[model samples]
Target: MSIKNTIKNWVLCSALLAALPITVTAGNKAEIGVVKDFKVTSQLASRDQAVRMFEGEFFRDPYIYLGPDDYYYLTGTRRHHLSGGSKKDWTSEGVELWRSKDLSSWELLAVPRRLGDLSWVDGLKAHSDEVGKGNARVWAPEIHFINDKWVIVHTTSVRKAMLYVADKAEGPYVETELSTTIDHKHDPSFFHDDDGKVYLTHRVDTVVEMTPDFNELTDNEFKVKPANRKMGHEGLYLTKVNDRYVIFGTAWSTDKIGRGSYNMYYATATDIRGPYSDRRYMGRFLGHGTPFQDREGQWWTTAFQNGKTMDFNTITKAKGLEKKKYTVFKDGIYLVPLELTVKSDGDVFFTPLDSRLVQPGPEEVQKF
Candidate 1:
């Protein structure tokens, strides 16, 4: 059968399966909703089935919240293993961005052109010899709302870390200069603490802090200690729960080379600045990551499970303080449920509730 027919059959089979309904409470109020449950089936599922339906390719580090618009924008390095060689030969497809109305259904926006796209090969080569070596390609693009505007933090092999600003999420994003400390910076994550302080986190020895405007760093800007002395090149999530700051990161140990082996881990700090302890493991054998809590209070961790599948694990509570794990069983984008427990002293623990797999409507699927 043609791929189209197979997809039609898959969709039909999926819809025919009954979904279990669950009640979701918002904050301290009573709210309820129904969701489907499914699991990834075949490796050969069409791109639409694997990604548009399953939200596979959209799994990148530093999933950032873009205001109360009920959307999270994520960006990551554009990889092209099929066209091997100097990274320069790998064209700047720029960065890929996705929009999720709910954490379950995602829409592909435009792949913004990188700074190098403004010129030709020779011109780009003149900009920096590193471009010739293919090390200057764009990597790890992150977006955040600051000073009433959306700002993007990204890296290029040539200049390392660069900043861009746009009035809208989708844009002809313009580049801006923030800092030039681009020695080993990749995974650029921006976070706004509860006290109105903005900080940038990335891999290099430890998560570093940048000036509020992201233009410069204070004397103690890079003084913050590392979360894990062993793990590097991972996502960073800063969330306030129960009035305390929580930090999440992953440790990579994949031997497959290129295929990263990362496991989800976290730590908590009384203050955003320093003195964080009580490190613990959340998800095992997960890599290239991001951990987030949805509006419905469902918590999820997105990671690459080797090169075969990108796993979205749902955290379920079996009892007090302990959590269970469920994979995105079928092939499609799913909003796994998450539960947040607030302590009287303001400490919060975000636990994964359950899995509610969602498939893209026929009209919503993108045509190649």
Candidate 2:
């Protein structure tokens, strides 16, 4: 099957599966199930000079966290302007890293080299007879500190996924082979559990246990059965709350145009490799959704709005099975708080606290 057809089928499967009903339970303890409605207030930060410093034409997938330097670092894909606006001009777009003390202000730290820049592509080219032509697109780059080393995982159209390591958070990274068969993988995320097990999660609802070396999977990769399988995409992050693995991700319409209007959802399981239950809608129509925990241990989600205005939404957990939810909407990167409510049949709904939030102006670039 062609990549286009495969994507179309995946989208169709997701939509069909989403119509099914899900049930919510509180860990292994509570039997009481109640449906609650919650709200979020859009904490729009002023896009003064400080905020605009992080603004750029190609900034998406804002993965923010404090680095070993005791400062926050944000990294994502960056695009280049080629002479002609042709598709071929979109070469191996590299990952860009930015640093900031506060979440609001950011500074460019490094532009890491691409996987094609490394020797791995030579191994891939060796298989070109079987896999056909190779094209690499650096996507959804994430930085994590593991075993006294800063590691990066990003997706590629050619090789699927690759792991790169560096001494520092902002990297001059070197690529190491992880998986070449997990093709079409995007939005790669890493989660280090309390039990000292590290896992990687990404698009298409797949998760795999990683070896301690963080270079390869120890077991066969498995799909995460979230309530609505079709609705999940983009970055996924895991945190253990109340002794349960809480997996959070954003679900958007498979249709590119329909994504901006979709909401975010999360699910929880007692086991990290889960028959994960209690799927709940966390928030709605938030784009490229990712979460970060503050120094106070409060969790917040950063999401962007679709269409004109391109505002940001910062939200927190408000009410429901989860303690509190919050969110905000502004241009560039935004954050929001989310609250999960359950229905009698186990369907979940995410209610945005502020509805009238403005998005950025329509992008002038032409779509492929």
Candidate 3:
């Protein structure tokens, strides 16, 4: 209220104004721009950059086996750009082995021998003229650990399903001297039942009895296909759930030409060598990949959708299925989580799980 006090207050206010830019003049306003963080331009970009695992290559007919060391081992048909008019040029060399602990990150383990280099090639080629024929590439290799040794049942051509044995998962897998079991089978897969019976599914599912060493196959063989003729099947994989024998395979009718018809389907049966019924559609555009159960009992599949890393739930309803027409896109290998459920009356159904359940890793999110 005093004049001296008012003068002192005015001086203090003037000093404060000189120290700080309380008001910006027109000349300096242009210079007062934002200091943007070039590293993080947007929230979405930042989130994408946080991904750590990268998407892998096209692993067609991917067969992954859980090893004794608690690690997952994967081996598939080696793919190459086969450019030629003749099928002989389509032969691929070695099968690549990949190992991963969490299923999120994978590392290349080794490149095993080609089918042509197998020890029994001399005998097999002598017995069957088709052994060294066109496009006789090793295809759809399915690996399994049986009776203390590793066994790989694979197809050399559309005509031969041969067996290879090894002492280790990551192996120098040697071909057994035995002859081809199913000469006209493609994508041969072995399934060990809870009842301790190991059944191999080649084109038409067959119950095969292996020797104690798992190298030799006995004459114990039975047919499981005529049970369901409607199933124009390919990529057969037999899995036993509870008291049911479930065969998950692919059935695609390319009736609409360009609108490619490749879809994964499944059939169920009470007996292994069954009258397997209830042929149902699983997902469209899924390539010849196998269904596997994780450590936590979660069902998932690693298949290709247009060559990309494509995976979806085995039991979850497939998303974006409303599109009447479907074309197989060359997307890389995709790994998806699936939910498989069975009804009280013994019916089984699968739905592809929510996409939100899987997040892109660093390999997927490119960082500059």
TM-scores across all candidates?
Answer: 0.61, 0.66, 0.67
Q: Which window of ten consecutive residues has the lowest lDDT sum in model 3?
A: 1-10
lDDT of 1 at 68: 50
RMSD per prediction, one decimal?
15.8, 14.8, 24.9
Off by over 4 Å in 2: 1-6, 9-53, 81-92, 123-134, 179-184, 227-235, 253-260, 305-331, 337-368
lDDT of 2 by residue, 1-368 (tens): 00001464344433322121111112311211221111111132322111222343434466766655667666665333211223323422456566655554455566555544566556655443243243345656778887677888776543366677888765667665564444555567787766677777776466788887766777667776554444354556666654556666654433342323444556766676676765555554455666555443434555653333423432222222112111233335555543334555554333444443222112201111
Best by lDDT: 3
Judged by TM-score, which candidate is best? 3
Tens digit of per-residue lDDT, candidate 1, span 195-264: 6666766652245556665666445554233354433334455556655666665543331122232344
Number of the candidate with higher lDDT, 1 or 2: 2
**TM value for model 3:** 0.67
Error of 1 at 93 (Å): 3.8
* Per-residue lDDT of 168 in model 2: 74
Taken over the whole model, the C-alpha lDDT of each candidate is 0.44, 0.50, 0.52
Per-residue CA lDDT of candidate 3, range 70-173, in tens?
78776775343121113223323345566776665566665555555655555555544443332345667777876677777776542566777788876777
